[model samples]
Target chain A: MRRKASLILLALAVFFTALSPLLRWYAFPRLAKIPANQYQDMVLEAKNATLLDYGTMQAKTVPKVTIVQTLKGDVDAAKKIDKTAGRDVVVWDGLSYVQGPDGKMVSSIPERYIFDAHTQDPVHATGEMVDGDPVKRDGIEFKWPFLTQKRDYEYFDAQTRTTNPIHYKGTENFRGVKVYYFEQTIPWTKVPFPKTMPVKGITPESVAKTGTTRWYTTVRKFWVEPVTGAPVYGEELHKEELRGGTLLGDRDKVTAFAGDVKMREDYIKHTVALVKSNRTLVLLMVSYLPWGFLTLGLLLLALSLYLEARSRRPGDPASTEVQEPEPVNA
Target chain B: MRALIAATTGLVLAFALVLTITAMGSPMGKTSPKPLLTTVPAHP
Candidate 1:
């Protein structure tokens, strides 16, 4: 009985020790998920320049930015796709508005997107983007699973109408925990669009000089928690320039227009605060408890072994009980 | 009787500890990021 009990305890200890780290999966998504009713207040200062002549610099304009992202889960995007338990598919609309000289706010380009609740991929968008294929895979946009290891992510670029394969840079010490770094580089190219399309917010004289150049370049970088796949900090810098004449010619001299040069920075500071608070509990379970159970269990097993050996010594009561009865033969 | 008692006591206590820790250690569900926009009015 003693031996059996001791063995059982030892086995139990091993079970917990081995199983601890795997619990990260269960803890992360449930603990760190982005809510459907999420709202973010951020600003993007668009740098626009006015030229005295074709090449002479004149003045600069700083536009105001107040973007609001809200979820619309009620609208069904795809009926054939099955709903996932614990996950909601949502369409989030973001409007980037810049106040014009008339003092009225005007809509910015690439206004809206749809997203996976967990992945943050822009699965769909409307307007000029309606014809282009919806984005398929964007891994770095939202919360990463706790089990995520080293990986390259194809972060979609809505402006270019293409997916930029942003490679995983490595891990960084972030907010006292390890987070991942990813980056994207977009070279100059004609984004998928029709030529001769009217460019919004540009003067006809400039538009006539411009003749519609769809060329653009973009780059983005982000830091995310590796364990939970949560983003800590992010920055995206996208620059575009309209070459003079038509989209066909690589006319370098006639840089007719400097496209939108904007930088956006975002971080989950509040999420970090919550993560810090939960760190202790996660650490105890994944690191401390297993070792504690194993050590205590081994000690108990050792004690049981010693007690058995001591009781079985030649003159001990247990040994005598087993000895043959000589005088009791009467 | 004494050996059985000691063995039973140690095993029971260890098992109880494991169970207590497991139950106590269940992860608490974190509240989703706040100021999550429940409604966005029609654009002007």
Candidate 2:
């Protein structure tokens, strides 16, 4: 009976010991992914920014410029893609809307981003586009992959429609959470006009017919929580100009928009809280639970071996006299 | 016989608990709250 008990315990020990690595490596990769129906929004503000007054065809200083960015997961779209892609995929329908201090619209651009839910690699589905133009993305975009490493990543730029290396600077404590800092600088590039212009009848085609083109550049920065790979805080030193166009009259160029855009205070606080909670969940699977199971397995195995060894000892008094005593009683 | 029954019951419960944890930890069937902005409004 003692030997049997020991064998059962030994089997349990083996089971748990095998489970540790399986949970961490196998289950984590397959199960820990971005949900297909996630929806999030953020507001960023730029104070004292320069914005072009299209009516006056000149640049003017604005008290504040706000950019509202929203990303909503398309569940049906993802499900359809999964049927053919043969793997988990996520589709995000995103919009970036810019407004002036008066709450008047400036420009808005729409995007459809498709990627692998686990790896965050671009899936290049049929409907992937930016600003109404079909684009085949090469690398990461708004979100990074889980367990992000300390190295440069090829980050795609919506304005330039190109990918550039976003270099990791170092780790820093951000709002009580350790985060990795990354920076990317995009050089001035001629970008197409927004498909939805602020003024009626002032379309991209109209602007191009006037011999004017839009140029943009930015220095983007993010403080990302490594475990969840989500940015706790972000900022951009962004600038745009309308160059050498009849729309600008005799002026060489006019600043369409220029400011240091930063996430709103309330949004920052909320983001930090969310990332902290998600970090805990990821750590539970990757570190805490796995290690706990392994430790428990080792302890149980030790106890089982001890019990088996003691039961098998020939010098044990109970084992030596047990048979004679039972026969006499019978 | 009672001891064997108890041990078997415990083992089954433990296995079930592990499976439950694995399913809960995954992203499957998890959906976020409703979004504030659904459709982009036309700009003037």
Best by lDDT: 2
Q: How would you encode candidate 1's per-residue C-alpha lDDT over A266-323 as one tens digit per residue?
A: 3255556655655555556545655575565566556656655665677765444434
* Chain B TM-score for candidate 2: 0.53
Residue A251 of model 2 has an lDDT of 86
Decoy 2 TM-score against native: 0.89
TM-score of 1: 0.54
TM-score of chain A of each: 0.57, 0.96
Q: List the residue pairs that clash in candidate 1.
A: A37-B36, A37-B37, A38-B36, A38-B37, A39-B36, A144-A229
Instruction: Mark the 10 consecutive residues where model 1 chain A has the least summed lDDT.
Output: A50-59
Model 2: residue A36 alpha-carbon error in angstroms: 0.3
* Root-mean-square deviation (CA) per prediction: 8.7, 4.9
Highest DockQ scorer: 2
For candidate 1, the C-alpha RMSD (Å) to the true structure equals 8.7
Tell me the spans in candidate 2 whose CA falls farther than 4 Å from its real position: A318-330, B1-44
lDDT per residue as tens, model 2, A1-330? 667677778767766776777779877887888999888888888999999888887789999998888888988889899999988999998888898888888988889999999999999889999999999899999988999999999999999989899999999999899999999999999999999998898999999999999999999999989899999999999999999978887888989999999998888888998898899999998999899989987988898888778887898853443444445563
> Each model: TM-score of chain B?
0.57, 0.53
DockQ for each numbered candidate: 0.10, 0.16
